[model samples]
Target: MKATIPVYDICTVSDGHQHPDLLTERLGSYLKENYQRVHQQHGHSFYHLVLFTGGSGSHTLDFTRYAVEPWQLYFMTPGQVHSWHLGPETEGYVVHFSTAFFRSFLANPDYLDRFPFFSGQSPDQVMEVPEKLRDAIQSVFEQILQAGADNEPDLVRALLLQLFLETDRHIARDGEPGVPQQKQLVLRNFMALINRHYRSLRLPREYAEQLYITPNHLNALCQDLLGKTAGEIIRERVLLEAKRLLTNEQKTVAEIAGELNFPDNSYFSRFFRKYVGQSPEEFRKSLN
Candidate 1:
């Protein structure tokens, strides 16, 4: 098999100059002109968010299909597989930016990852704008639209930060009651650590050590909030990466196993099959 899925870059030029590592556009015109690119199964190398003010449809991200509606906000981190199908009337605002787009101005480069919508968990990445805040959020996107058109990178970025913060604030207010703030921070930090080290640290104790919590406390935290063991959390991340890597049809099974740091192809296949109910090749074949 050869590589089939396209990974898009944040490369665009406006007028006679190359635009910075960001792109913003109206969803209607964007899909109208780039129908195939938006509809096809592909990945992007930038952070993406879309606010749907009208239309009905569904979007698939990382193999999970999410039913979309008006006043819905969807965000995707780089490298996640994506595709969508919607009626012609669907319209919204889309903003795409690379890591450098924000990191250059902020001291902390991974600040956006703190938002649950940017967590890369398929379900977590989709948020429905509350009725009262819909208009406010729409106003922000409109400002973003104008800023993008004016080529005001600084103003656009400020609006982007505002949007992210507003969304995060709402999510926090809507979260389950009784989850302590400290516990929430610890869980998020654990997730951040997992995202950075899943390729090497596959043990609950290892993560517990880094988090300054005992293994039992970490496991209890996972079960209380996420309904899984800390070990399972780490393993699920590894499995997700396995699925993502298998999407690259150019890679052989052995090569993928090596890249994932598995001892051998057989070990990787067994692990994948145990959880996924099929071998990696079968999973990949099903996608095609």
Candidate 2:
């Protein structure tokens, strides 16, 4: 029998190019058959917004899975382990860019604060754009593809900012009144710290102390807006990293455990099994 390879391991782009900017307009038609993009214990470090224009499939990002269908938009943030099981007839346009791209547009460290799509919220708020909005998105891509052959950084940046703003507008129109700005700032800081130290700092109190807030307050705020405790958020972040390491990297469980600051390999195995419902090795085999 032929072996099924994992998607991340094989460069999905044609011409063996890895840069997202270069691959922007190119359609990756072979992604459906080339790999089983599984969410092993460790996740990824890039953000992708996949827009499904036709066909059907199922996608899992973080802990939520959605049935993919026509005219659906899915947001996959950095540090989340996600997988897409495309139908035999799946068709879509995907816009993939790194956080570095945002830096060029916003030019400030706090720029990410403008967008809620990156906040790691559950039931990921992916809006199904109306035909009008869809047309706008397509037009941006058309302009991007037609803007002279030269590398037009200015045009590219403008289109990207427009895309993000449009996404933000949709989110605002759909979402309930979010947490207050001060509290949101605190939560954003807490999230950033967790992203930086998820492997080492597994406790909410660890982050609370660093933020100079009590654990109880942090938990209350997270519970109020996210419907989960702060500790649960931390666990999700840790598990996301664990999934990325297990699926995307070649490291052994013991090596991953040590890196994540688990006391022993067995403990990490138990943690992975509890949340992922599979042993680390079993998850890796499923991807293969």
Candidate 3:
């Protein structure tokens, strides 16, 4: 049998949604029905953000574990892998939304991408809500919950944006040194490119050529904002996908190599060993 990961959409988790684009609910109620799946490794077809006002456990996103603590907020873009453990008393607010959620409401379709937490990088996806701002953020989530119950998509959308804006203001506040808008734009484009073409175009120069920038300039942009060279970013993406596939036990190592378009299984094994510090089979065994 071919192994695959579970990828959920709005309807799969909830029903009777007049607004199919967004769903907000108390995390406890959600867990009452979804506890099993929530603990299993899976991906979502929509953006998922949760604020833990009261929780004790952990959330694992793309293989990185984050402690579940009060006032912690986590974000996930579409297609990212996530799972969690929870205490019986765990409670919070969770909002699941689709790309279409804001595209119709705002003039800019990519506006949500501007927020750092929504970047889907595991490190950037988890955050501790600032000490003083916890109450206000909690209130905003309450408002969103009420709006969601009323099936008011517009209000829900606006409040979500407000929540993001308020959180980003304080969270990224260390004067985030006003990176040039152009540089930010380029970085976003580069990341998008990497996601779209990492399997085939593994070279930074190839991306630079597409962006009409030199390889050095591309590396500088990545280094300045992301603390990694452009090439490393591309390789990280490839490795992430490889790991995701490896999580599916039915797939053989050579099959994964072929799926990733590696020239041969030996080359793929070498690459995995060089970075992952173990053979693919060893990694799979560790998971077991």
Candidate 4:
């Protein structure tokens, strides 16, 4: 069976107020309670930005695990899997939005260049949301909440825009321009290509050809900035998606192998085991 990219919808919360939107407030409550209850819970689909204002927790985010503490922020991008083990009496605010929300903003050609935060940087790029900044975020959420229920869409859009701006502010305060401007652009384009076509294109040279550069050059840049060879990066991306489909959805191994463009089920199984240390079926069973 040929594999198909599953259809999934982006989740958004809209309100027409200037105060903290009800959705954020409600989600914050749920996160506070659940973070405490399930020593750990896995997130599927939508991206979440969680601000840990109090208490502590352990979070394994996208192959990297970290301890969550007060005044710290963590970002979970769409398609990245995460499991969190909450500390006792955790308190925080969580903002959930879909890729659709980001698309509306990134439709502008210069958006990604202006904001490097979306670029796949190390997870440690997260910074503390300062006290004044937190107050401002609270104000925006509160405004959205206060707005009468009549204009939900407008309120939600406003709050989302404010949130994005606040995130940019935090990034600006914390991020050091470690990568050169030209290299950053190259790396950004490389990531965009992989994110869109990782299933079909498996070789670093393929990406190099598309970028009009030598494979050796591309590997050099990737190693210098991302600390990984081009092949390693590509494999990581492919395996990440494979894991998502196998565990989150009811897809058969043969179907997934076909979608990933393997020549045969046996080849795909061997490839998966080589990188993941287990067969696809074994990994899926472990998730269950």
TM per candidate comes to: 0.95, 0.75, 0.88, 0.73
Model 4 misplaced stretches (Cα beyond 4 Å): 1-22, 26-28, 32-44, 102-106, 109-175
- Candidate 4 residue-wise lDDT, 69-167, digit = tens: 776766655566656677557776665555554454445743543344454333533566677777776666566544424446556666766666677
> Tens digit of lDDT per residue, candidate 1, span 1-288?
566688887773112323567778888877787788878788888888898989988899998888879988889998788998988999998888887898777888888867777767777788788899988999999998888878888898899999988887774332545778788789888888988898899999999999999999999998988889999989988898888888889888899899889999999999999999999999999987
Error of 2 at 66 (Å): 2.6
In the predicted model 2, the residue pairs found to clash are 40-243, 41-242, 41-243, 41-244, 42-242, 42-243, 42-244, 42-245, 43-243, 43-244
The local lDDT score (0 to 100) that residue 256 gets in candidate 4 is 88
Q: How many clashes in each candidate? A: 0, 10, 0, 13
RMSD of each: 1.9, 4.5, 2.6, 5.4
Worst 10 residues of 1 by lDDT: 11-20
Q: Indicate which candidate wins on TM-score.
A: 1
Assess each prediction's global lDDT (C-alpha) against the native: 0.84, 0.66, 0.84, 0.64
Model 3 has an lDDT value of: 0.84
Distance from true location, Cα of 175 in model 3, Å? 7.4
Indicate the residue-level lDDT of 281 in model 4.
86
The residue ranges of model 1 lying beyond 4 angstroms of the native Cα positions read: 12-18, 172-177
Model 2 regions lying over 4 Å from their true place: 1-20, 26-46, 62-64, 77-83, 87-89, 98-106, 119-122, 130-132, 147-150, 172-175, 276-278, 285-288
Q: What is the lDDT of residue 207 in candidate 4?
A: 98
